[model samples]
Target: DQTSKTSYDLVVIGARWTGAVGEYWRSKTTYEVIKTIQPPVLVAIGEREQLKRFLVCTGGKEFIEQAVQFTGRLAAAVNASVTLLHVMAEPPAVYADMVRLEENVDQLLESKSELGTNLRRQKRELERLRVSADVRLRHGIVIDQVFEEAREGDYDLIVTGTSQARGLLRHYIMGDLTRSILNRAIVPVLVARAGPAKPGRTLWKAIKGLVRTR
Candidate 1:
């Protein structure tokens, strides 16, 4: 008899814009975004886990460098691995244009030419950081694909970012992807809010400061 054994310390689902943003913050700030998350309940699991792996699910639209950097840091801190997953949704024939846009890997790579360059640089950094990492491209619903991977990979935890709500009504409504993953995920989940902070401003400010100094 053979036992199927796969394990990871952590797995982050939903590699959307928010996830990328979270990665950026984590890389730059000394403050622990996951630890300092509002409500405190969200990151409890991540804090408790010793060995962690981050599995970031992307739609192929997001910049891979951000995810790589974030995971690289977490992995180095926890001595874990970072895995990237890209999921594709199928559409009807009438949506050929949309399908072409989504399915054309070459075009997608070309479109984010700068991001691709950044990813290469980050990959080198990740290697120096000694974090094991790999990227996978798959086809299916984002939520379903993540769940399936979680089970198969035997991930101990999943982390994702949420949207800040404006009011009580908005708070009650979970974004579709978050809602689905939360409802179906078998493992513990860490939800971080991707608040409306302008992450780029810090870089811009630094640039301006350099100009003044010069």
Candidate 2:
């Protein structure tokens, strides 16, 4: 495939509001293109100015490092400020009793928790790249927190990472966080996927499924 054959620095795509409209009427082309493409995709929305402030939402996932590095490089190139944000959403059942969502950034960074360590490491990495960044903490719904930070910070771009999900139906029916941000973001969103390249066969299968469901 062309994606496998050639290296890409970034893929820019447009985003729009489709939530009010029925899912069946929504175009699948954007989601499909984002899924198949390997490069970091920038879903541009609304009006934008010269790229400056960047709000990077980090979840300490496998792709977080890659996404942070990507944003760091971009920020370094443009001399933009970056704020690393992690929302303390409701914990899963495994850690629901133990995890607290109200800890401040200073407290989180000082603790020995995995999230704390990852935040500190990412900040150091950004500094190593000669990019200045501040770590911020939030609580409540992940997407809502992100939107709040973006507006309050007046950020130029939002950087995020996504974990791979199998099959197009999952992407279509249960849209992932990154895609959700893309669809609703007022500013541009940069999404980086880390893992093996999604095979062409999977794309074909997903397309077939889309057709069958339609």
Best by lDDT: 2
Q: Choose the strongest candidate by TM-score.
A: 2
Tell me the tens digit of each residue's lDDT in model 2 across 73-156. Answer: 999999998899888876677875455533567777777888888888889899999998899887789999999999899999
Q: Which segments of candidate 1 are over 4 A away from where they belong?
A: 1-52, 60-68, 91-125, 163-174, 192-214
Local distance difference test values of all predictions, in order: 0.51, 0.75
- State TM-scores per candidate: 0.49, 0.74
Q: Candidate 1 lDDT, tens digit per residue, 55-133?
A: 6554332333444455566668878776655666766779879666645544544455543443345546678889876
Residues forming the 10-long window of minimal summed lDDT in candidate 2: 166-175
Error of 1 at 181 (Å): 1.8
